[model samples]
Target chain A: MAAPASFLFKGKFLPLVLLLPQLIITGVFFFWPAFQAVYQSFLREDAFGLSSQFVGFENFTDVLSDPTWLQSFGRTIFFSTAVAGLALSVALFLAVQADKQIRASTTFKTMLIWPYAVAPAVAAVLWLFMFHPNIGLFGRMLNAAGIPWDYKLNGDQAMLLVIIASAWKQVSYNFIFFLAGLQAIPRSVLEAAAIDGAKPMRRFWTVVFPLLSPTAFFLLVVNLTYAFFDTFGVIHSITQGGPGKATETLIYRVYTDGVMNLNLGTSAAQSVILMIMVIALTMVQFRFIERKVHY
Target chain B: MLEKRSLWPYLWLGIGVLIFAFPIYITVIGSTHDISTIGRGDVPLLPGGHGVENYSAAWAGGAGRFTTTPAAVMLVNSLLMAVLIAAGKIAISLTSAYAVVFFRFPFRMLAFWLIFITLMLPVEVRIIPTFQVMVNLDMTNSMAGLVVPLIASATATLLFRQFFLTIPPEYVEAAKIDGAGPMRFFKDVVLPLSVTNIAALFVILFIYGWNQYLWPLLIVNDRSLETIVVGLTKMIGTGDAQNEWNVIMATAVMALLPPVAVVVLMQRWFIKGLVETEK
Candidate 1:
């Protein structure tokens, strides 16, 4: 959106004064730290945090070549894909049902949407309490049924646990968006499809699904970003990149390498990489929104 | 959209609602039971007599195995943090958006772009560097450290700017004709017109702030300043058999209450703000 050109107030200093607080906070907290991350990514610090030397692209190259980092990268893709796929599909189903003429639709919506208020960390804790091997009901039930299911000891189980917790919390958010998208579709289109003798499932795939693509695509970007960045608390509180780094995503690795292991240069490089990804995703989102506006 | 008499929608909704309710229902029920009942791996679907005791114990002081803090303190800290962040973000964004939309100035677009770029630098990406910045500023272990850095909101600013641009030029002309100064016009005209947007944004931002985990986890080492969201996880420590599951569940209930209440009570505004801002 462009700034208004016609009716305007004339004040040079007042406008700047008004803009100062936001600019200051953004500069100090955002731009400065981002610059520091980029700068530190190029320098290598000693073990004692004493002296540093210019390492140029060595840190990025080393992080890129590291097997553990590469594995973490792959795991992040798997984790995010699983989360987005599960959350989006489950939410779509629920939203479609809720969109129907049903009893207590608002109640159903509220019940489903309240989980959106739950913190990722809290969501993790809830799932952990339910799935802990020794005390959890489901955990004991699994063991009793001849399967071992300790997330603490098993990497794959831990991955599955975090995925469930993360996706579970995210479904509420996607549900709201999907429901909105579904409601936005005109009834005439659906009626026409039904008059053409298309079944409910067939009509959905042929008409409604295509109409909802923009919303689904938007949610895909958002869910990927959520899985990539916002699930840090889920990973940290539940798994902490545990069971030999199996649950470690890119964000978790950045934390473990930097704060836990004190590997500053590599962590900074990873941060820069994450920054680039966020910028790219954000640009895609904005461009898509611009296209939607045109339509 | 046309299936009115069919029972299929009801059936599907029943199952969906049940699935959504199960976890929270379990947590609430578990919180009511004695620790031994849950510890024995018996899932108690019914309420027990220890509900009050467990909540009281958790509220007075957390009952984790390794570390403990007062839940009351954490909840208060979370409330304050959420309010400050929401208010702080709204206040700054309103002014800045006012400046950008109403007043002509050099570098105005520069300022707007600077704020917008922060959309990319989420706290997760710049953890170490930002933490180091906090340390260098001696802002660690303080409430300002928890709230201030998070207050400069790009999405809020953009939302307000978008809304502000829609303000009729006739209003500005009328205010100018009446000799109303900028601040006077802002106080008399802009604020009133933006109440619904502000309220909607407050609901969304309050939840965003209250549910913050990593930033509070990183900067606030002091137990007193720990937010409920972060503290509740700390209460679970290692999630072992020795931990007090009842107290943790009680704390979880308490932690989720305020934001859930806000969203439910302000459902209209929350949905409006969420749908609008995301666009």
Candidate 2:
């Protein structure tokens, strides 16, 4: 909606008073820390933050040049792509199937959507339990089937585990959006396609899929953002970027370097990089994507 | 509407449901079993008789060697944090949205943008500096530290502003005609009319607050103040010997119960809030 007309209220003092609490919190919590992050990214601090010297672009250069950091950057891109692709496809498949049913659709929706309530950490733990080598059901089954599957020791297996856990937690979210988008499509169009002698698959590809592009695109950005930042807990609980740092994504690197390793400058630089990526994503979503979404 | 359908939809949906439900089902069943059964790697698909024993133990006394805080304490901490964040967010957001939509104040757009920008800077992105700020303010290990930083919500404010914009201008006119002051009008009319939106937002925000993992992990170092989500992770140590699988699974079930219950129970409102807020 357009900004409301400035029609009635007169007391500017009262309005400021009303907005005071939010402004204060935003100032202290959001803007201040953000400014500090930008500032700290340029400065190298000793272990205890007692001494600091400005190193313009050095922290950024160090982070970009470091092999582990570069590897994490590549790994994060791969992880986000995999999570987004898997989550979106599975949710779209489920949504299409669920949308076709008349009876018990809400029941299926309820069953599917409750997993959205499961926290990322809890999701990781649940999956970890299912795949724990010593005590897990599937772990034992896999070993019994002559395929050794221990995520604890194997790097590729660890990546797959975290991806599955993260994607599992995100499926419900994408399902709801896809289902809504599918339902919002007009039935008459599909009916007309059938009258034109198009088969189900042909009609879906030519008509339905094109119309769903807007929803699919919107979900692409959201899911990528989720995979980037929100899956920190998933990575944290599952592998902790373990098995020789194979599962370490960019966000986890920020946490480890900042909190555990106490490398403020490097972590702050990473934070700045992440903030830029997110802002760019947000801008792209609002500027280009929202305009293209077909209502 | 145009094509003949068979049992394929049901079959596919059934498979999907089974895939989603299986892990939770296994967790529930595992929680019911004893440590020895799980330890022996003979994971039963059925519920065991030790459900009461395992749940009670995990609830009263924590799970593993690292878990010094009981599930009860973590649950309480989570509940309190969730409720406080939800209520605090609603309160501040409503007032701020009111000011922005109703009053022509200086720096209005600036204020709105400042709050909006916070949406892009999630806690993960600014972990170090934010943590430094918390440490400087001596807010670590406190509930205020856990809740306040997370409460500056752009979504809630935007939702309220959208809702407020839809209120017919006649209502404000009528209130003015009746000599009701701004505060009175807000309290009597706006507050009453916003009940549904508030409830919807509460459902969404409660789940958000309860499900918070990283923020609590970073801010609250006190074991007693641990939220169940983080506590469950802590209970599962890196090694198998240190992890009590049965108890950990029991606590995992406990950890998910409240938020899952809220979503299921308030399914309609939660969905509406979710869809509308994102839009």
Candidate 3:
């Protein structure tokens, strides 16, 4: 894969020159900081940056023993699962509906896809507006209906709100992929199932669902990654991991610990852990998931 | 074609559309109302007569009392950040991809993998250390500080590599036979062919740049350098007290419009680019 059998440029210096800008930027911004994170994880540093001491694996041990850190890890897993599950199912449902030939299908597609363009922060703000207990439309209606929906005070409600908002932003992306996957299926296969007297529901379960598994699985990983790292803005703007840290994910904890609290060692350890998780997840995506995906 | 037609599809599509559109519709309507009306705890579902007043207030004077940076400055900052990040990513990625794909050089694969590894290190994970580096470099509160570090990822380069790999070797051969240098062939031949991919990437990257919250929030303490997305979030305050819902909603609308318009206008390219790039 590195060297394809193609006519190539002969000058060695030109290629180096061409790659210089990216290499320089990556070296300074990517490699340097990543190295710093790894190095700092093992060293305990004061907030004022006046003193430091080498403490091997102490920060990691501290993070592992910390209840809040462990809770955040568990919460991040739960959050990612909920986000990926909700976003995938909703998107797949809509994609299946949109796959049918109907009037204004294009219009529905257009409406559904625009939210992908909305920033996560903005998405949070929009949802917050509708869900604000006092002045929000749904919040008022929910309270009127006596369901007692106040995300601000209720932990579960706060989690649900952030989940819904994050999942809402992701649904559009999942929908596009599912639609593409659905369209890629050969019509003949569905027709064969239809002729054999398979009902639409049964056909979907056995034939369509199995065929769409690759896309579904692909989206599951993507959505999980999004929920893990990309939903920071949603969590930040909506709950700020508030109501007593109910919505705090690993990424948000990293931010709060490092930037807000100035616990450099713990945050650096968390950063290293987060980096490993992402690398592991990305490897799964590239190695296992890509191999299984048919197309 | 043999399937029976039912109202089920329409019902599902209608529900889906409604669920997605309701927030945006309500946001628009809310933006058109006065703060007093919105603050009364029961927002009208219809557009109110205060659209111009609310939007102009948000545009010129900013929203909440705490955030005095107007929407105009924030919008400009967001636009500049988005455009520069998009353009910068594309430019560097294109050249780097060209080098990796077209030339056989030492450590070529090593360079490619080095860049590829950065994908795993999102700015969020290494936020503290990266911030430390920025401070050491004295890059905080500048556009370069905001844009450069974020563009170090290899997604765009990988996308360009994927696109470049599909171009027939004959193009290179033809250009070579005609005495065209690598740069010339890249400029005249390869660049033209990659236009659609670039446009599609522009839409995605523009949104990515515009939506950046955490990095900007950390790096730029100067209110003047705030992007609209971050500025809008700051405008919300901790609670409803002294918070202008009308102006906030209007700012949300303003924040969302440009990217949404780009996606809607370039729907085809955006979709194509998204599907292809993810591969």
Candidate 4:
């Protein structure tokens, strides 16, 4: 029936035809590539992205047993959790404040989030330079305040620097989602709490927060996913997984193996591991966690 | 009481803003200081003459714009790709959404989950194999390389589908009764209501397109095919020659424009659609 169709159709197959292009694109670009990534992980590469040599589960076994690999994985989890938690909380607080409609709120919202537009590469430079021990802005400020701070050498401090930088960039994004969540709360509910002599904080925690669970849950998924994969630029520029791998997350290892070391097979293996973790993480969030998000 | 109670939160936001913006401001100031002075790590109220000098190196650096002006060219190329991506996305999504919600489509639930799974399997997860496919298709550095594969955006499709559901089906029914075909019904009825979603998707896709780095860097080795992001990363990321601090920052500052523009302008529209998404 759609064979001669031109401008319009009511056939059952019409929508499928419309969806065909994107679906094929997805199959070719997304699913097929994913299949290849999984397959390549079990093999070995001689040149960049070229390969042959099936060692069964050898790459997987090696990756799993390696301490550095484990360290990278552990560091990734630690990094992702810290960045997401801090960013979400700080953002939630800002969202609450802005939702109150303060006189200066619009101005603050505009400038505070301006950095979201700044490239992560630029952000890396900004942080590394700002905290540079000798002439960085934070360094000079620390001198003025009589506090000691230097990000170049100390592993713990370097980790803190990346975390803080990551957290700062993400606050604006979370703030947006949280504000939307807050604005969705019915005014009547808040008013009822107010009339019942409930304090402001109580009204928020009791009346508003439950309504915001769905958004919180949505943001948690989005933020965690972002922290896991998208931190590539930040990690590359800020630490390069150094002051001796203190900040090397899984993705860093992927890049190092693939691009730096040219060990594409091992890199593909790491990428596959990352893909599995993220998919598993996202599924858990959607299946178990998201169910608890109340309207 | 509510006003007074929320006061402390406002103060906390102030502190939050200070913490967020301080690093940027510090960088802007730091970029202008001399590299010798920069290496020395001095913070001054005014900048030294290093800003111009640094730009010279970052521009010529192994990753500099001169070495890869094509990447800057790719910025426009990416912008063109983004425009198509956003428009094509809206068109396909709207048609599909209207079909599922207004007219009954067979396998509708299957379609929804299929689309949703794309979000789960993001480009990052599939990038390795996608590269293989791209090579097979002979799309390594062509415009098709950048645009065609990405024309499929699961996020936009899902968002539009969600947004379209919120529209009153009564309008479509009314239009159908008036002898209006689905196309006419969609054009005259549905699109009028999706202004916010379209705008939001445009801004989001534009930023996503602009901010992309790894794919373009990995797949496209020809510098001319690179985007602003790849250009900036190379300009700064190179291990060659003690990096000129001022030039790298200055180049980076210039690179920041497109995403910033999208954020500033479309943020106003984004808030409205954020509610729709939540709903």
Candidate 5:
């Protein structure tokens, strides 16, 4: 960890005053809300919010026992895995190409990176426009070829559409990180491998891949977090977790239950579950960092 | 670097570029065509003559069948929200980081950890309660509601602290010898030195604030407070045949331009900010 500066200003109230805005915002917005989610998880209330009873872990039990919630949890894992896998592999491939001693590499990088600016919802719209089944170009082509290809009606198709859209939006971010990772690899190591009769592909596998593992692992955690939480916009815009809950993930279920259905107790329980998942992911990342330091 | 004369790199890169660019290409081309043309489902590769007409219709409003706010109003609201969020985050993070690094105070570690813990609690996981907090504060549908709660950034504060720690103790000693106060030293020495970090951070945060979806969607039912990202998705509605594909595509294009322009234009700083803040 980075240390504080050795020499410091001697101020009592000034430091507290300086820290107040962030503290207050964090207290009221971040901590309080998070605490509320945890608190509400244990309480069951009427739909009208008229009365509530403290049921220790009943809400958690209810959420855990619900087959739909279990399926959503399983679906979240599958969806997040697909998104992270596709995004990471595509970005790694493109980053490898960009890392080459080729012409117009900067131009290629610029083009690849601009998609990072597209909002997840906007990204969904672009993909939806392309695959909208009626007003879509590829969607029209698929139908004309006698393939049944309406995502709105088909569950698997809707799942595939969301995965593509979400991964497409993420490739740029992973590309940036992967490119930086590739560039950071020492040239001397690659040169030494080349002198030992290693071909480009072999060098990449033996020398480069291992060197980039730290980044690859880092991107994996980041991408999973993104797929879990950040893809809400993509799902919201394309399919509101529809076609009989085919595309619904844990995050989507929480929104549907809490905001749309007003099942506060169950929704709060799910939120607590997701919060634990995030904390777990973060701790895993920190542990990896610690291991890297030891190495 | 080992150099090889080959088309393999170019070929792979060309294909990658196409995959990344095709959706946007379709969006741009579709925006230029009329509703009937796009609705027919097989949009042409080239731009159509209805570009100005589609853009103007979407810009002014009433192009689509849905009851809607104008693209112009939503764009302005998004800009205001984005600016406030970026500026607010930078301001608060800078001051708080400055305090933690410069001064010795009681409960300093406690204050720092409180800020740090927020990194785990994204607005996504805590949506309902945050909305409840907003409702309780009477901040719903206001600009403050959209901006303030989101501005307390752990990453930004940590980044600033990381940067601040690198400032030489000699500089602080000299400032102290010259009888400079903490605020004065910060304004003169710290702020000027932090320009690059701030500019880079502004690029990331601006895009963040501009692209916010679920939060704005929940809190701002008011048409006047609609942000472009949420507004653009709303424009698409349920994807029925009666929708105005041309106008919707045009608004999507308009919504994308500012943040994309910022990223493309400030490519260097954006990359630096992104990599640094994540670290």
Candidate 6:
């Protein structure tokens, strides 16, 4: 969307001019911080904010080589992908199903949003109880059903539990977006598909699903970013990346490193690498998904 | 040929709602239980005999914790800081968005992209440098340190500007014709007319501000300076000493009230905001 030449410089300067103070604040606070992180990633450090060897890429290598670091990075990627992929699929499925309902729409809508209204910490703690296995509703139900499940004993089980919990919280958010997307599709198009003898599965696959691709793609990137970084609270409450390094993620590593270990330099370097991966992935999404995104 | 109505849809919707709403039910049930009952995992559906006990424990605990340490202070502090930051954000975003969407200016496109770019640069990547700024300002452990950095949310500005763009700027022109200054014009004409958007924006900002734990965790490590989110973490406690589940749930329930209030009170406006942007 190129700016029209008629509107380019004519009477546009005033708005742009007014936005300058905001730009300055953002530049100093946002741009400067990002630049500094990248720059610091290259520097050497020790006790008392001291060092100047300019190690260039050595930090990246050293950070990656550590077994704890490598394992955590892999786990972080898995955690994020699982959360995002599962959440997106379920949300899309629910949205499609809900859109077909002539009755119970308002009830479903209200119930769906109620979970999201709960604060993150509260939701996480609540889940911790449900997944407790000793004294949770799910625990009791599973016990009654004669299926014994414990996330504490098995790291793999813990990972799956966290993923499920994260996805459960996020599915509502994605449903909100997907519901909006579903509503945006013209009702006439669906009616036409029905008249054309498209079966339920066929109509969804050929028409509604394709039409929702833009929204799905948008959510894919957003969900990935969120699951990767923003889920520390859930992790902190549920497992604290515990039962060994099984649940440890990059963001958790950053928190433990920067806050607990007080190794600001190493943490900052990790943050820099994490940022680069995110940016590169986002750029790829822009380059490819932007073109592939169906309107 | 097919009807849009389907029994399958309603069945699925009902189940999905159950899956989503189950956690809250668990929390509310947990809150109404006694410590022994909660620990026993015997928290049942209806309000148990422990409702008064739990609520009183949380309130009494609040006074004890607030005086002896920072948890109570943190809650009050978080409220104060979040409210201030929220107000600043609305003011800053409104003025800035109005400037760009309603006014003519050079590098207008550049300003818009700059806003978008902030959305690009993940704050995880930028935390150290931001903390560095705070440290340099000698604002560490201060309420100002907890806030000032957040006054520039790109997402909020973009949302505000998008809504502002649809505000029929002929009103601004008419106000101008009546010799209204920019400030007066914005205060009297634009803002009053956009109460719905403003309310929606407030809810969004308040939740974001309230739920923020990471930044608060990083900058304000002192227990005395903790927000409710960070304070909640402290309840889990040290090695060998088991955390009190009933009290924790009580705190969690309390922490949750603000966001719930925000959502319920402004739900109509919030849906309107979404509807407007979707259009």
Q: Which predicted model would earn the best DockQ?
A: 3
Tens-place lDDT digits, model 4, residues A241-287:
77788888887677777667767567677778878787787787767
Residues B102-193 of candidate 6 have per-residue lDDT tens digits of 55555667778887677667666567777787787687897877777777767678777777666665666667667776667777977887
Q: What would the per-residue lDDT of candidate 5 be over residues A1-295, giving only the tens digit for each residue?
A: 3434536777799989989999999999999999999999999998789999999999999999999999999999999999999999999999998998888888999999999999999999999999988989889889989998998899999999999999999999999999999999989999999999999889999999999999999999999999999999999999899888999999999999999999999899999999999999999998997898898
When 1 and 6 are scored with lDDT, the better candidate is 1
Could you give candidate 3's per-residue lDDT for residues B1-279 as a string of tens digits? 547788998999889889888999999999999888988877899999999988999889654453457899999999999999999999999999999999888999999999998888888899999999999999999999999988764989999998899988888888888999899999999999999889999889998899999999999999889899988888886755448888889999999999999999999988987887788
* Candidate 4: docking tier: acceptable
Q: Indicate the TM-score of model 2.
A: 0.97
True contacts kept of 3: 0.80
N/CA/C clash count, model 6? 11
Name the runs in model 1 displaced over 4 angstroms.
Answer: A1-6, B63-67
Candidate 3 residue pairs in backbone clash: none
True contacts kept of each: 0.75, 0.78, 0.80, 0.50, 0.78, 0.52
TM-score, candidate 2, first chain: 0.96
Which lDDT values do the candidates have, in the order given? 0.91, 0.90, 0.90, 0.70, 0.92, 0.72
lDDT of 1: 0.91
**Interface RMSD computed for candidate 5 is what?**
1.2
Instruction: Judging by lDDT against the true structure, name the best candidate.
Output: 5
TM-score of each: 0.98, 0.97, 0.97, 0.84, 0.98, 0.88
Model 6, position B47, has a per-residue lDDT of: 73
RMSD of each: 1.5, 1.7, 1.6, 4.5, 1.4, 3.7
Q: What share of the true interface contacts does candidate 4 keep?
A: 0.50
Q: Rank the candidates by DockQ, best first.
A: 3, 5, 2, 1, 6, 4
Residue-level lDDT of model 1, residues A104-161, one tens digit each, is 8898899889889888988888888778898776888899999988999999999999
Q: Give residue A216's lDDT in candidate 3 (0 to 100).
A: 86
